[model samples]
Target: MKLMVSFSRKKVSEPIIARAVMDTGVLINVERARIEPTEGDVLIDVPDESARTVCMKMRELGATVSVLRDAIIRDEDECVDCGACISVCPQEAFSFDSDWKLSLDQPRCVLCGRCIQACPHGALSLQK
Candidate 1:
């Protein structure tokens, strides 16, 4: 399960994530993060079964948690596979496989909107 964990300045100094992981015994994979001095959020992946446990632990530590499952809504038919997304993707989430087919690695995506704008066919969108 993917989660967006947000923390304020007060909570930033607290080892919230570390505590959550230790308490739940769930290894959290932090995919992306933008933590400023005042506030920030992290995109993380956890075991599906242990996601609830992690979320509860994080919330107990005063962190905001939001689940993002199948966050990317991809339209294969609308995609032309022109490599527009592949060219502009900062995380290298979009790629062309050996068969010359486009592939999307969702875990690497940080929900950046660049790919949606780069796509001429409007094949990709994020679920709110």
Candidate 2:
């Protein structure tokens, strides 16, 4: 329940403030200020106790486990501007470009995954 979400940059003297939460979901917007997860970051989905164990293991391995989730977000980018996604989202998580293409507001998103289903373009997933 107390998993941390850290931003790790190799060259930076200090990583930015990390986010730790006890939530069930996260945002999937790849636009501005998005904390995109990479391959080496640890993902946990078990109970809170198990998550603690995993966090300890991650720390032992010199990796920081910043947040815990029951799922990993794999978002799709096949947006063709049909505008179906923007309409269904209660949070207005998606927006449009000048060309009418779709862009995401990652910080404003809560990763509800509704955009994935609402998409006629199949532009969202929970894979990575």
Candidate 3:
């Protein structure tokens, strides 16, 4: 099976691509440019047709691929340079660039909500 990554932009753009695999718990897509998925992006689930079907249906519906866990935590532009969430993230999922804007690595982010609970501005979200 093939995993199709759909972007919100026009079809002329390249769709995110991944091979089919089983035991994969979550598929994440990051809007920010700082973070990236290099390896081990695939979960250990057995390869199957059902997983492929789910992915296709979600793409057709324009759902952003993410683990249920990560979607619970929120990431937004209002994140101040508080550095609170960065210290507590078990997955080290949160980071900031030179501009001090928060960047979330969706693949690495498990969406534990430590950051989400800590944010005072309430800017973080797991939605697409």
Highest lDDT: give the candidate number. 1
For model 1, which pairs clash? none
Order the numbered candidates by TM-score, best leading. Answer: 1, 3, 2
* Model 2 accuracy (lDDT, Cα): 0.49
lDDT (C-alpha) at residue 26 in model 2: 33
List the global CA lDDT of all models. Answer: 0.85, 0.49, 0.49
Candidate 1 residue lDDT tens string, 5-122: 9999786467777877778888998888888878888988898899888888888888899998667778989987788889788889889999888999887778877998888999
Residue-level lDDT tens digits of model 2 in 1-128: 43443334442223222222222223221222334443222222335556565455445444555653433243445656677778777768677889887676654454556777877766666444
RMSD value for candidate 2: 13.1
Provide C-alpha RMSD values for all models, in order. Answer: 2.9, 13.1, 12.9
Worst 10 residues of 2 by lDDT: 23-32
Q: Give the TM-score of candidate 1.
A: 0.74
Runs in model 2 lying further than 4 Å from the true structure: 1-77
Cα lDDT tens digits, model 3, 55-88, are 6545554434433324544544676667777878
